[model samples]
Target: MSYKRVIRFIVFIALCVQAKQMVAQNANTRPNIIYIMSDDHAYQAISAYGYGLNHTPNIDKLAEQGVLFNRAFVTNSICGPSRAVMLTGKHSHVNGFKDNHSTFDGSQQTVAKLLHNNGYTTAVIGKWHLISDPQGFDYWNVVPGQGEYYNPDFIENGVKKRVPGYITNITTDFAINWLDSRDKSKPFFLMYQQKAPHRNWMPEEKYYHLFDSTQFPVPANYFDDYQTRTKAAHEQAMEVARDMHDAYDLKLAFDLPKDQQKGLAGNWQGIYNRLTPEEKKKWEAAYGPSIEAFKKANLSGKELAIWKYQRYMRDYLRCVQSVDDNVGRLMEYLKANGLDKNTIIIYTSDQGFYLGEHGWFDKRFMYEESFRTPLIVKWPGVTNKKIASNSMVQNLDFAETILDMAGLPIPADMQGKSFVPVLKGKKKGDVHEALYYHFYENQEHKVAKHIGVRTDRYKLIYFYENNEWEMYDLKKDKSEMKNVYNDPSYSKVKSMMQKKLMELKKQYNDPVPVVTPQI
Candidate 1:
């Protein structure tokens, strides 16, 4: 060979080697992501949010070490649809999962798919309530639809098996096991989701009596009359006093008369039967006295309602305590394994729940309690420690933001914008001028179909089916007691918000027809 050709070949080989080294460096430097989400976990219940309803020290550690978002929300407030929005970075209408009844279209592009394609080993363990099997993950072990809190069944990579433990602990066990077994050379994206603090609030045996002695303060609007609001508010069947089942929700069926247990027998029995002999004994020992005392009190009128509220709060908070303890366990595991420094930890919920807000329990409303979700992110080096951001972000942004964090190109068709700039402290202001929300389900809870928009201070909601409108100056009416849509004093503000609402609907390509109520 010629000397000139030999020199050129040497240069080419050197360049190829340099390129391979750079690729390896980039792979190692990219942070591992652990996205932790809980079902029906209200922001008000978290100690970091300052409601002080319960103590969540472990979950609060995320806020202590990173950014706590004050105004994070969901596009849709229901379970399945909200998950779909987070996965696809699109609204329910575009994603084709508008309600609990609709199955998630797994073929569609998702952040998991994007990350998996771009060399991140992905796994999701815990509650996968989206009906269809999860796709685009190297590993997935999910419980079948609204998973049981005790001895839950997990479908691990298409194989179903009953796992013998509390759901929270079991889910964490699977996650930690996967982290141990994963390919350490590649960056990982693990969705360590939990089903604790969900409905039928069942805590692990250790936490069954956690809040039994504590007296939770009732919400100011616990007895909301819904007089000024539209028929939609009055029609909802989620009121704690009226609709919450005694046996199923409060766990009072065992000692109650058969007549009082008529409609609640099946639900309560199904949940109770899930416990083993030892677990059942422990559960009864913790709750048996309370049940007997409640019956003997012969509580009536408002007193009975108050008693029920306390019972509900105790059970619910116990479940939350379990979740917090498990969060601490997961965080310690990450730190012990040397993954903490290079991992991006995100904690959020499917959607917020009502803790007696406006006399309600289940979420489906575009109201503040259900519409807003908790978002706490701990990005090792980028996010500021012990800070709070009021930036208006939604679950719709999750996919795009995750892609951006992985240094991958976001798809042009995705509807949500990446908020990585905010996390990096580059963007100081809000990412969105206005946020849009639409709830399509008119089932279970009987909350009417509604669409709304919320800006910094004002909110405008329209119950299109009833041709009703409700406006709230959230700055003044944070509790949302008064409906001032027709108030003559704020006509100008109402008009402006209405116009913004239409712009958002158009921007989001929402197909729901607008029916402006005549004043």
Candidate 2:
């Protein structure tokens, strides 16, 4: 061969050797990741977050073992959209999940896809409510709709099947089942998302009597008037009282019609179906009077509020109990298989919720309750155990963090910076000097669609749709009860936040108006 041809062959051999070594390096570095998320599970609901209202021992144990993020937030504090953020590692604007109405564009580049390309086994199990066919999942079994209390329908492997089991139990069962069968050769990434403690809070039969006698405390801001809020605060039909129908699932009306002359049989539906015409008429008359009499004898004042609290909290806590118990089950499974040490376990919710805080039940407001999410990370040989980080972290940061953890390049398209630095105890003070929030397309349980920004201690929200602005010095008004934006003392603070907001908009290519609308 000629000298030039000999040189070309040597270069080709060198390239082949380099390619094989790179593949081997990628193979050795992948980590097993288990991500568990619950619906409407607030940071305050977790005992680790220091809320005494609920008991969450297993979840608390996670905080004891891993680093707990003091301040982690979602760009949008809703279900489907937040999940999209986690999957795509991008904002709603980029992911096309601007709201629940928009479906997930899974064909686009995703974290799952990236991980899968880098040789990680990926599976998503539980409530996949993107409202479209899921993508980037090797195996997926998810609840359809809000699912059910008794028999739930789960769409699995492209087939919808009715599983004769409790919703929370079944979702966890599927999650464990996936984990048990995961490929051990390559490290895995499993998304265990649950439909717990969401709307119409219902628990399994075993957990039905869990909180039978407990008097769950009412949220601090449960009786808030809409004096300083938007039309949404006054119009949303999700209030604890004054909004529920008598026949609603909660059934707190306490008026069951007793058979006047006879008694209800075991087969009430059959008995009623076979009732004689005259017997039916008598039953109706008796039932109407019985229900009315109970209604007329109203339970109001403190008595009524306590009843509402009991109903709301009992159901809520029961759902949480199921979720916590299932977490224990997953942990036990990991220990048994010897995967606990090498695996990184994360538990959190789609977004923080208002558990009767400020007289509200739903989220989506720029308030701390909705904006702040519960993020607990237990990374193998990475996170500082038992360290509680009070830095402000956004869910958007997860995209960067997850990719960086796996030693993959975080795409420039993802605006969220990596907090993996903070988790590893490399940085101090605030992670993000400021966090931006924008909520658009305002419908669901009726939370106002507004855009806002949160700094270390102060929050400023601009109600663009309503042309109103609210500013809060979070250190003083943690409950966010007072708006001091109009005060002369905060004019300087407001101006600075507004300028920061403008800088973020320009940086992110979002040009929101800074002009004040004429009232």
Candidate 3:
């Protein structure tokens, strides 16, 4: 061969080797991600939000280190649909998981599949309430259908196994184990989820008596009359005093007579049956005194209501305590493995819950307590110090934000915009001029199906089924007690909100028909 040809060949080989090294370096430097989500965790309960209900020091650390979103919300305030939105970055209707009764379509595109295809190891552990088995993950161990609190069963990679321990602790164990065993050559993403603080709150044995003596103050509107609201508020079956059951919700012993047991006696019994003899003995010992006192008090009227509220708060907060402790465990694991600096940590909930707001315990309405969730994110370089944003972000943005953080191209079909710019302080003020919400479940809580839009200072809602409209001026009526739709002085504001609501509906392709205001 000629000398000139040999020199060209050597240069080509050098260029190829340099390109390969660049690609490898880029892949290694990408940040690992840990997405931790809990079920029905209200923002008011987090001490970082300044509600003063209870202290969550470990979960609060994320807020202390990163950005705390004050106005984060969900597309739909229910479980399955909210998770579906987070996975697909689409509204419930677009994702085809509108409510808990529907099964999640596993064949569709998801953030997990996108990341997994792009050379990242992915896994999800804990509550997988989406009915179908998790798809597109290298590993998944999920609890089936709300899951048990004590000695729960988990479906690990499609195999059912009964693990003997508290559900929160067991779920954390699985997550940490996966992190330990994952292939170390590539960056990883994990969805560490928890099922605590949901309905029928059950705490671990260690926290059984944690809040037994504390007397939590009742909400000011605990006796909400629902007079100025739509009929839906008056008809919901989630009131703490009226709808909550003794055995199922309160965890009192099954001592009531068969006629007065209200068909809820068996629920607690079934959960108690899952515990071993030793565990059951400890549980009964912790709760025995309260059970006896409740029965002897013969409580009636408002006094009885107060008693029930205290019981509910204690159990619910206890469960939250376990979740916080487990979050600390995961944080320690990451720090110990030296992944803390290179990993992005996110803490949020599927959706917000109602902690005695409006005389309610569950979440379904478009009210602030149910619609707004807790969102805290810690990015090593971008958000290393404490800051906050009131940008109207939603769970819809989660998938896009995750993909953006990993330097992957977000699919065009996703309806959510990445908030990374806001997180990096490149953007200021709200990311959206208006936020849209819809709820379709009309079965359990009996909350009427409604669609609404929330702007910076106003909200407009339409109960299409009831042919009713409710408007709230959030600046003056944060609690949403008054309906200003019919007031003439705010006619222009109502009309403006209605127009914005219609625009959102059209943009999102929601098929709900528009109803003219009845004013």
TM-score of each: 0.95, 0.85, 0.95
For residues 132-168, write the lDDT of model 1, one tens digit per residue. Answer: 9999999999999999999989999999999888999
In candidate 1, stretches whose alpha carbon ends up further than 4 angstroms from where it belongs are: 1-24, 255-264, 516-519
Off by over 4 Å in 3: 1-24, 254-263
Candidate 3 has an lDDT of 0.91
The candidate, 2 or 3, that scores higher on lDDT is 3
Candidate 1 accuracy as lDDT? 0.90
lDDT of 3 by residue, 1-519 (tens): 899999999999999999877656755699999999999999998999999989999988988889999999999999999999999999998999999999999999999999999989999999999999999999999999999998999999999999999999999999999999997777899999999989899888888888877989898888899878989888889999999977789877644555554456766667767988888788888888989998899999999889899999999999999999999999999899888888999999999998888889989899999999999999998898889898889999999999999999999999998999988999888878899999999999799999999999999888999988899999999999998988898999988998898889999999877666543
10 residues in a row with least lDDT, candidate 3: 254-263
TM-score of 3: 0.95
> What would the per-residue lDDT of candidate 2 be over residues 401-509, giving only the tens digit for each residue?
8888888898888888888888788888777899888787676566667778889989988877667788899999888888887888888888888887777666766
Q: What is the lDDT of residue 26 in candidate 3?
A: 56
Clashes found in each candidate (C-alpha, N, C closer than 3 A): 0, 3, 0
